[model samples]
Target: MDIREYRESDWNQVWTIIEKVFRAGETYAFSPEISELEARNVWIEMPKKTYVAIADDDEILGTYYIKPNQPDLGSHVCNCGYIVSESARGKGVASRLCKHSQQVAVELGFRAMQYNLVVSTNEGAIRLWIKLGFEVVGILPNAYKSKSAGYVDALVMYKELKT
Candidate 1:
């Protein structure tokens, strides 16, 4: 699989996954009825960088976006969000994208990485993140209304990069 910078042509596939995840209301805080243009601005334009994980045939399997946790004084600590294609889940697609994103973050001169809103019910992601060396720095109570889990907490995870 290839994890590389996102291209304009990648938006269609990326949007497919984004729409599904957002509509599911299981993780992201985005409204289920979020429109394409809004999604584009948030996922593409707002980020410092975006990436897609592709198969050998160039089929997009997963995607991630990295940006500043906050602008100016806090920009050195980067932030990220990820979504894996439905068919690609459980195959380590998200894991690879995450690991790759850290390197990319470092290359982009970020000194740390932070996941500001990891839904508490997403155990697989929390587990993988811990395995990758991120710590749960804080928990926002009743932060996300997950479809299946109802009102759930959100974890704020942080990882200091080696610079």
Candidate 2:
């Protein structure tokens, strides 16, 4: 598999991956009823950069986007969101995308990375982020309205990319 910059052609496949995750309402903060145009704006247009992980056969396995965590003075700290196709989970697609995102972050002159709303019930993602050197810097109680778990806690994860 390979990770590369997202192209306009990747939108349909990228949306398919994110749509299911958004509709699940279990991890990301996006509304379950988020529209395609809105998703495109958030996932593609708004971010500083977007990427896709492609299989050897050229299938889009996963995607991620990196952008400033906040405006102006906080722009040195970047934020990212990731999604792996159901068929690609457990195959390290998310992990690879994350690692790639960090490299790209540094290349883009970001000093750190942060994830503002990681649903606490998502153990796999938490574990992977920790393994990749992010820490749970803060927790918001009952912040995520999970489809299966009701209002669950959300975590704020952060990592200093530069010393």
Global lDDT of model 2: 0.95
Q: Write the per-residue lDDT of candidate 1 for residues 58-158, one digit (tens) a residue.
A: 89999999999999999999999999998999999988998999999999999999999999999999999999999999999998888888999999999
Separately for all candidates shown, the number of backbone clashes (residues 3 or more apart, or on different chains) is 0, 0
- Write the residue-wise lDDT of candidate 2 on 31-147 in tens digits: 999999999999999999999999989899999999999999999999999999999899888889999999999999999999999999999999999999999999999999999
Prediction 1 TM-score vs. true: 0.97
Worst 10 residues of 2 by lDDT: 154-163
lDDT of each candidate versus the true structure: 0.94, 0.95
Give each model a TM-score: 0.97, 0.98
Best by lDDT: 2
| Candidate 2 residue pairs in clash (backbone atoms < 3 Å) | none
